[model samples]
Target: MRSIVFASGKGGVGKSTVTLNLGLTLAAAGKRVVVVDADLEMANIGILLGIDATPISLHNVLSGENEMQDAVYAGPNNMRYVPASLSPEKMERLDLDKLPSAIKKLDDSSDFVLIDCPPGLGPSAVAAIKSAKEIVIVSTPEPSALADALKVRALAERHGVKIVGVVLNMVLGDRSEIKKEDFETVMEVPIIGLLPEDVEVRRSAALQVPVIIRAPGTAFSRAMRLLASRLSGEKLAIQETKVKKGLFSSIMEFFGRIFGRK
Candidate 1:
């Protein structure tokens, strides 16, 4: 199985959101994908999926209260996910050491195992990083964020974990934002993806649905599909969406054309 961990140096970089959607995209392409919420302290995969409560989670497996398979739950698009417990009691009993073995059990069944690691260089993050065969750093187009990512890259290199490039999220293409080449130059890792900030993503998360499922034709979803194709080495089809132009659309188009703007 391809064990890939998605990590970030700083929080609020959309690491969990990108990881979840990528797993779903892979699953949609007919690959057996499993996403594990390894961010034990602030596990939000369940919240993103609109799952308020689960009987068993990663905490249970680590605490030896349940098997890894028992913690796996069904998700959309035939994808399976291992959500982390939100309970403070379970968090207290979490055994980070057992995480590796617990993840190992899923190797036989899954083609791809995507771990959503916690931010920073904490013990939990280190444990998750060491457990993965490869790591993908997620960052924004900011020096501060990239600086933190560099630290994570260093940590992964120290452990000899293969760096699978970086996923640059929430790219707005503003002049103030760092260029792609600069990011690569600073981190010494290629940018594997450039996910744009889309309002649809926010709407989907509010509805407890992934953007890929809720709005596949949107730019964000298309980019996600392309990213999945690049990783899977298969040219997955991009779904095209047709829009009906109304009076509002015509007016906007006319103004956009006149002003040479969107």
Candidate 2:
């Protein structure tokens, strides 16, 4: 299972929005995807998805009050959603030790586990990072968000989790101060995606639907789909692949070996 955690240091960086869209995109592509609202403090992920039923909140799972399956809610398009509890006690009193097993169980069943982590590098963020196979840093192309994103990148590298890549959101596409290329160079990680600032982003969130599902034709959705493909290891004709054929010499050898038996 591919465990992808989406986190940001500052608020309103569109981290949750991206997580929602990414989940929908993966599910649309036939991947068995599940989203865990790891942001236990301000877990409003259910709100964005229009999930009014409480079902089984994360509080129950972590507290041993219920099994992980009990907390899992099937979302729109059959995507599974695990909402975070707004209860203060659950956030403060919940034991971190029990989290690993419960979360691992979820990961084992899902093809892609997308975590909507809380803002800031707090205990929740640390715990999410510790459990994930890879971390995706989301930022809004602003200095404040960018700085925090760099910190998250460092944290992922320090913790030995692969920094899958950094995602730049709310970009203007022509912004002078925010060049997408500089992000990769400075952070020492690949820039997996660059999402433009679109009003549909807010509207989709307001409607509890990911932009991809709500407006698949929009530029935002297209960019997200491209990102999904890249993350899934899909090779596009234009994108560069690591293993080059060395200008045809290796290819000739492969062909030669196949037909040389004749």
* lDDT winner: 1
TM-score of 2: 0.85
For all predicted structures, in order, the TM-scores are 0.89, 0.85
Compared with the true structure, the alpha-carbon lDDT of candidate 1 equals: 0.87
Global lDDT of model 2: 0.77
What is the lDDT, from 0 to 100, of the residue 92 in candidate 2? 56
- Please write out the lDDT profile of model 1 over residues 1-262, one tens digit for every residue: 9999999999999999999999988888778999999999998787776664588999999888999999999987778999997777788777899998888999999999999999999999999999899999999999899899999999999999999999999999999899999999999998989999899998877666677877887888888988898877789754332322331224345335434577
Alpha-carbon error at 201 in model 2, in Å?
Answer: 0.9
Residue range 155-226, candidate 2, lDDT tens digits: 888888888888999888665656777777777878889888889988766655567776777889889888
* Clashing pairs counted in every model: 0, 1
Provide the RMSD of all predictions against the true structure, rounded to 1 decimal. 9.8, 16.3
